[model samples]
Every structure is written in structure tokens, then in C-alpha cells.
Target chain A: PDPDAAAVQAAMARNGQLTKPPGALGRLEDLAIWMAGWQGTDRPHVDAPQVIVFAGNHGVTARGVSAFPAAVTEQMVLNFRAGGAAINQLARCFGARMDVHALSLELPTADFTIQPAMTEAELLEALQTGWDAVDPASDLLVTGEMGIGNTTSAAALAHAICGGVPADWVGRGTGVDDAGLALKAQVVAEGVALHAQARADGIEALRCLGGRELAAMAGAILRARHLRIPVLLDGFICTAAAASLDAAKPGALDHCLAAHVSAESGHAPLLAHLGKAPILSLGLRLGEGSGAALAIGVIKGAVACHSGMATFAEAGVSEG
Target chain B: PDPDAAAVQAAMARNGQLTKPPGALGRLEDLAIWMAGWQGTDRPHVDAPQVIVFAGNHGVTARGVSAFPAAVTEQMVLNFRAGGAAINQLARCFGARMDVHALSLELPTADFTIQPAMTEAELLEALQTGWDAVDPASDLLVTGEMGIGNTTSAAALAHAICGGVPADWVGRGTGVDDAGLALKAQVVAEGVALHAQARADGIEALRCLGGRELAAMAGAILRARHLRIPVLLDGFICTAAAASLDAAKPGALDHCLAAHVSAESGHAPLLAHLGKAPILSLGLRLGEGSGAALAIGVIKGAVACHSGMATFAEAGVSEG
Candidate 1:
């Protein structure tokens, strides 16, 4: 709860100075202030928005949780390299740089061994790689993910943390139908069972069964805080990553902003756990931080409200 | 449906040539194609977006249908003049210019007469004012609204045009209470009863009991079409305006795009009556074109999708 109410109050007071009316920017005003606190400044900027796409092979792909094949992950990584994926589009949208770090939590990469999440050193090494990607002077970090059947992984991570039923959490990952959803629930249940014997703690649970990308994202969020960078969490799996980080570092939620509540059922639980509210919800199930990028407008509006709005005194307008 | 299938198909083909992936721009892609047909260009721009804000006084305001005083309608117009209103903020978001015109259909402005919807000459004059404001060279026109207790007027219009119970269409307006909503419903029922005289057509019914602003907006939408300008309809009241226009001229919907749905119950009926699918729905009940302006981002995305995405030929990328 280190929201820095004084800083928030100061930001609210400063909002009247902007060209617009008081509180007209809505949730964006809150985002700018939260960003202000994260940056410990009255002015915040995305000087360096380090975007990472955490990829993993979902066990639910075996059960058909996606319209695309499990191989789309590898193919999309090549697409990312070719600047053909939605994430590549978004990277251009924010003028942000993206890194596609292949995690060996599931399938071993071309040169790396398939590392068990249970191994503390391996988890640390994966996280360190993610942390090392972000520059020390970066102002903000945004994490996005790409994976077929990733919702199953998200549901499993949420189930592990919230002790919720897998059925209540599983949803249409990339437009899965009823039978596909049922199959997804079965696979998530299996993953939960397989990882149940691992360390019951936050980082340990992630190390045991979480995707390399998710674990790395968790590490990145934590490191962002350590580096004084604001981290904007994108969509469901990203929220799961935030939850893992929150579980590891009790106050990591302080540095995290929930970008949007994905239509995914698992998203609500993670947002609730983190005590964060999404900026918008337009039935967007598209990953690649599309919802998050759309939310930047609100953030900009909030900043404008704080920086450009005219206070009653400034406008010489009568008050209630 | 004169939806130029070949043109739309060609537009879809051209979308991938812009810079992003195919369909990465989502709804914005649709907007671009729609604009291409309306503006008859592959490169469409909202260089002069004609936004008309229609204000009218609602009879349901006496029933406590709103949070602010019904007089706030007039006050909000002044607020619009002072640029202290939400719609003004929204208009700024899109860098779109707006004109707030008071129709004689509502309560009389301090300087004008309260012309009911039945007066064709007065109604035509207001519509002309809205039309005159639009540049003939404009790519698009957006119709927005501001009226206190106007929801009651809109519900009545929806019922008259779309055919629905006043109760089903009634809800909290401007922060009304349970009793206020009940009273608003009673008033709406009365208004509908009094205005039930219809000639089996939308234009006739609207003229009999519609607010001045609603009728003017309806006129603006129609005029925009005659001028080949596509209309972007805002929330509840604006939808009512569009329905009126649709009733006046069949296929009016062809010239229109529903910007966003409102939380207000009347919106669905209006949307249904006009046969439109809204682009966004964020529980927006405030009607100063904030939702429309918010949708501007989506529109920009759409235009960007159509204009910026790289074609397969250019990218040398393989498709599924």
C-alpha cells in the first residue's frame, strides 16, 4: 500500500493546472500519478520501454486450446524477426524496442537445455537474462507474450496462487469452443498436479511449471522496481507474471499497472489479486499488448489533465 | 447492401501493404474500408471532421432523471462554450473541431424560444446551421449530443421508431435515484402516449415529439450523406438522431458508423433500430462525444491498418 498518497494528492492538485477540467482524464489521471510514484517524479516518460515476448509451449495445445497450432509459437518468433506479428506492429506503435527471449522452461532452445523451474539457479539465470535486457536508465518496461495454449498456463499459474478451480478459470484461448475449453481445463488440471510437489512459494511455483517468458516477466517486473522503472502489465499471462512477482516480493504490485482486463476469465483473478483495475475492456482477446497500447491514450490524457488542464483559479471559472 | 464487395476486397488486400500485419489494425481496418467507399479513396483522412452537438431539454428531467439540474443542459452548453465539458475534452483528443448548437426542441435557451420538434421550419433551420458548419470538402461528419433528461426523449424516440416499452428503456440519468427513474419512466410513458400519433414512418413520428437537437442531428446525418460525407454516430441520444435520419431516408445507415454503445438502456434499441454494431462499449453514459472521440483512436488504428500495413508481396512474408 505504498501508494504515496502525498504524491498522489500533489498530482491531483496539479491536475487543475492543465488546460482541461478537474478529473476529466478518468483512469488515465490515476495511471500518470501511479507512474509518477513509480518514477518518484511529477513528470514521467517511457524513455525506454523494454518489451519482452515470453513464449512457451502449452500442454493445452495437445488438447487444442488454440485455433493456431503449437508450432505457431516458433513460426511467430520468426514472424517477430520478420516484423509480421501484432507485437511487431505494436512495437512500432510505441516506438519501443522488443526482445524475443526464448525461455527453456518447456522446450529447449537451439543452444539452451530445457531447464527445470525447480532449479533455483536456472530460474535465477533466466530472470537475470530478462533483467539484463533492460537498461538501468530505462524509464518504463512493457512485457507482452506470444504462445499457443498460453491461457492454459495462465489458468494453471492463477490456480496455484489463488487456490481456485481450473474449470472456473479456463476460457477460450484464441477462440476455443466448448469442447476445446473442456480439454483446456483437463490439461491445466494436469499441469497443476504435476507442479503440486514443487516449492509452494511464489517464485518456486513459477520455477516449477511456469513458462520461461512468464518467469522472466516476473523477474523483469521485480527488476524494474529495483531499477526504478514503471512496468505496464499486458493482458492475462502478463498479469499472472505480475502475480508471481507479487508472491515473491510482497510489494511488487506497487510497480505494476494492469493494462486492461482481458476477456480471459483468469485475468479478473490476477487483477483482483494485484488490487489493480484495467483502463478499458472492449471484448479484446487479441494478445500482443494491443489492449495495453490502446490504453496509452488514457495515460496521455491523464498526463495532459495533470499538465495542461486549467484550474478554476486559472480559468477564472465559477465553482459549485 | 451497396457494400462494394470488390472495393472492400481490394481495400482488404491493400491493408497488408501499410506497415503492420494483416488484420493487425482490427476494427480500424473496417473504418478505413468504410471511409474508402464513403470518401472514394484508398487514402482517407478526417481532415475536416464535422461534429455537431445537439442539446435539448427532456420532460423526464421533471421526473428527476438526472444528477445535475435539468438546467445543466443550458449550463453545459455554456460549459461547452467555455470548453470545460467532457465532449470538449473528447473533441480535443481527436484534434477534431466541434460546434455546440442548441435546438429549439428542448427548453428555451436564455436567449431563444423552445421550439418543439413539430415545427418543421424551425427544425430545418437548426439542421441547416449544423450542415453549414461542415466543410463541403470534409471526409467525415460526426454527430454528438448534450441534453439533460434527453434519454427520456431518446427512449420515446426509440420506442416510436424501434418499438419498445418505456420502462425497458428507462435507467438512471445523470445520477438519478430509484424513485427518479420510476418518475422518468412515468414521464416517458406519458410523452409516448401523447406523441403516439404516427404515419407509419420514422420522420413523421420524430417531428411529432422528438427534441429539436435530435431532429437537427438527424437532419445533419442526412445532409452529410447528400454531400457524400460519412457520419460517425455517438452514444444513446446520437443513435436516436441516427434512427430518426434512418427513418427519414432508408439506407441512411449506409452513411453512418456507430461509434460506441452506451450503458444507457436506450442505446441498444437505437443501435438495433438503425442496424449498427458499435465499435466500443465502456459503460459510457456521459454524452459529449467522449465515446466517439475515444473511438477516434480505433478509427486512427483502422486508417493506419488500411494505409500502413505491408502487403505480402512487399514483406515477402508467408501467410497461413
Candidate 2:
């Protein structure tokens, strides 16, 4: 469903009357209005935001594509559950409710360099898990991932959907050295080439190249879109997850925000290709939705000011 | 006093042990270390951040240099005190203690195009007012201002200290039209020309070209520097105020962070000149320390992740 047009118009009208000069709030004004339309309220606010971290193990980890071993993905899920990860701290700091989902960690996805990463049934189940995980009461959503070799899968997804070579989409995921970077790029090239159907179908790309957690994030984002909940897309891997949706159907990400460009080099070109401008350029490379979670504070301030501030008339201040 | 170096090293060592990959947290890591050094704690947090807003009237408003009337300054000050302004909401949102001080509102600063904006006594008093307003107990500080036509004052100050021509420093402050922008550029050029001594002396620039509120911000920033309280420079005007301190002495803003570059065109060049990279480029042009206040969330998230997250040893997760 499209955002309510009347609420957006009303938000714009109210923003103009705010004490500050028109457009002085810059992208914040646009963000507030965007939220207003989605929430169907001229006064937009996000009191119950949700941060979900999906964890999956990748068979590509056996290829020396990642610095961390595959078991770390499951261990990090436990860390998240124990509230000891970076995402937990960030979510708590921003007053967000956080959840972690570990998907078939014992059964890693197939190595995409050799064949498809997931069967259609596996992809559908992962997407269903993501869709069912979203809490309907959430006014805002952020989907993040924890996977050992997911960046390889993400790079392959980008290479497939955006028609890029491996190097353009690959980056040093989780502090891999130069040789690992080169090897990951080569793996991405091979995986993307082997899955030619992915280039023609965004959903096909998910089955052929993306990991389970990445598929879950895409499903969660799609659920948010259907529910008219505003979404803040995290760094590179998460962006690629959402990009698959946009590729399958253009404007699928219209309800989502490219929260920040990560330290990953591929994120910038991917954002450009999707025509989304990230609000933050922080050098964050963490993928537990940490960057997007931190940005929750920014969005809160925007809505707080939008709803709480006095208008020119109410303040009895002269307007320009 | 400089930041505590020992604490900084301790924070860096702690950051390396966090569960996430090294440098994965990006500039958040640096911000945490910066806060740690200033607060003299390995676990840095901004529990009692202070936001001070100084309001004054600019005599240059008589020259049609602003879209807002001079009377709007006092009115906006009332709005701030009434907790009805954008800054009030933002400060509240970030859990910062908000204080507003009206500095000789009845006595507008002299128009710098004709003569120095303030006499030696007036500049000293404004500086003293700013210095005294800061609470020593607060760990973080952000100084903002409300004054009609102060952008003209700020642009003039930047021109004097940074050696830029008027056009290089002037911008559409408070939504001025093309003609108003041209007039502001002319005003800045004339002000810089009339007060040539300001070009050589940063303090002289404040006395000759800066408004009372701007000088107050400079003084407050200096106080934070002395107390080793970390500061977040707001938008163009606030950055200009802090630049005055840096001009008087190299590394004057060493304890400060350039929070964001504003919509004002001069801000980018000014930040570049100072060799400070802003964490945000949100196109926010609203004064009253709004931009920096919005950034408190980012800083808080950084420190929270730095201080609260468990190490790989504690979480029992494999390290990269």
C-alpha cells in the first residue's frame, strides 16, 4: 500500500509553520513527512521500533572467504541472545526492542560458487520465518544479519542483480586480509556466473546467491512494506538484502530508508544504483544493524521536533 | 587542560577486545576514545550533557540582511524558554540539560559594516557570560545561538579568520532570497573590510565582526576546552564561533567534534579549513545547537557500544 497522501500533505503544511525557517530541517523534514504518510498521522513518532538480527552459517566459509569461522555465526547469535553484542547495546541505547533469529546454523547453505546457495523451498521457509518474526506493533523496523561468509553472498547478490563484476561488489568483510579479499571476489564472480537466472529475477538471486539470514531480512522488509511500517536499512549486507526486493519490483524499497553507507566500498555504488541517499556516512562495517540502530536516535529527534515544536503562530514569532 | 591520555589508551585497548571485528565500529571507536580521554574513564558516557543557547539581537538586521525581524530573536528566546522551540525538543530528546541565556537583548551589537560589532567591554562581557553558563559537572557541551542576521555576523567572522571573500562565506541564512543573499555577501565584504585587524586576530574578529551570541558560544567552547569537556560543534554559525578559538591558538578545538556540516554552503569550506570531518552532513541549517543535539544520539550509541558490549573472551565467541 502507498503512504497516505493526505497525511503527507498535512505534514508538509505543519512543517512550514514550524518556528524554524522552511526546509531548515533539511532531510529531517522529508523523513518526518515520510513517516507521517506511512503511519497515517501528521504527527509522526516511533515509540516501538524493532531491531531483528538474523543469523545463518554459509558453506562459503569453507573456502577461506571470511576471517571468522562458521561457528562464530551461531556463537554471535548466543551473544546477541545474552545481550552482549554491539547491536544489543545500540538497540537499548535507542529504546528499540531487539530479537535474534538463528536459522539452521548446523546446516550451512550450499557453496554458491559450485551451485545455488539455497533451494526454493529453503528460501521460501527462510522468508516465511522473517515475515512471521515481525511484530505488528512496531512503528519502525531494522533488519540486520550475522553470518560468517554472508558478505560473499551479499557481493554475489549485488553482482547478479546490479550486473557488476566481483571486485566492484566485494569488500573486506569482517577484517579479511588482501588475499582473502581477492579470493572472496573471485568466489563472488564464479557464484554470480553460475547463477545466470539470478540476473533476470531478484527473487531467483536470493535462492541462487544469498544466505538464509539475507533472505530473512528481505522477507522482513517486505512485510514492513506491506504493513506500511517505515524501515531503516542497515549497512552493505542488509542493503543488498533490501535491494533484491527492489530489483524484483521497483519501488519495493520506497518505504525503506538507506540509513547509512558503511565502510564497505560496495555500499556507495549500490546506493547510487538504487537511487537512495544514505543519511549517515559513518565508517561502520558491523552488520548487526548497528549503524541503522544508532540512527534510530536521529529519526527520533526529527519526529520529536516535528511534533513537539511550536508553530510560528503559536510562538507569536514573526515568520519570513 | 588536555584530555587524559592514559584513559584514551585504555579505551582503545578495550575497543579491540569487543566482540565485533577490529575497526568494524568505524568512527564510533574514535569518538568513544575521544570521550574516554576527556572524561578520564575507559567507559565513557554522556550522562549529563549540557546544551546552552545564547540569544541576542544584531544591529545589522536594520540593513535588511535577514528574513526574520530582530524582534524575532527575543520571541524565539521566549519560545526556547517555553520549551516550544526545535532546540528545546532536540535537547530533551537527547537527554541534555537545556539552558537559554539572553545576553543584553536590549542592546544590539553595532553593525560591523559601519564599525566593530562590539566594544572591548561588550565582547569581554559576552565572553564572560558564555564562560560562566557552562556547568562543570556536565561531560558534554553544545553551544547554540538565536540572533536575527547573526549569519551575517558569522559569515563576516569566517571571512576575517579564514581569509575568504564574502561570497565564499555568505549563504542563505534563515531562508534569505537571492537578493537578500547578495546583500548579505555585500554586508560581509564591507564588515571584513571595515575591520581589517580582525583578519589577523581571531579574538579581534569576534569583537569586530561577531555578534554577542556568537562570542558567547566561543567562550562556552573555550570553557569546555579548559575543563576537558568534549563538545559537538553545531552548524555553520557555531563552527564559526569555535573557529575563533582555533584561530587564536592552534588546536584550540582539539577536544571538540565537528558534529555536522549544515545546509549553509560556507560550512564545508570552513570545516575543510579547520581539518575537521563532520560526522553528519544532514543539510540541517537550523541554529540553536539543533544539529549537534541531534548528533548526541550517535555519540551516545558509540559510547554505549564501547562501554557495554562484551569481549570475545566474555561472550565465548571466536575472534577474527
Choose the strongest candidate by lDDT.
2
Q: Judged by DockQ, which candidate is best?
A: 2
Model 1 lDDT per residue over B258-316, tens place: 87777777787678767788876556666666667767656654554455545545554
DockQ for each model: 0.18, 0.88
* Candidate 2 lDDT over residue span A220-282, tens digit each: 999998899999999989999888998999999999998999998899999998999998888
Fnat values, one per model, are 0.03, 0.89
Model 2 interface RMSD, in angstroms? 0.8
By summed lDDT, the worst window of 10 consecutive residues in model 2 chain A runs over A189-198
**Which segments of model 2 are wrong by more than 4 Å?**
none
TM-score, predicted candidate 2 vs. hidden true structure: 0.99
- Per-candidate alpha-carbon RMSD to the true structure: 5.3, 1.0
Q: Report lDDT (Cα) of residue A303, candidate 2.
A: 97
CA shift of A43, model 2, Å? 0.6
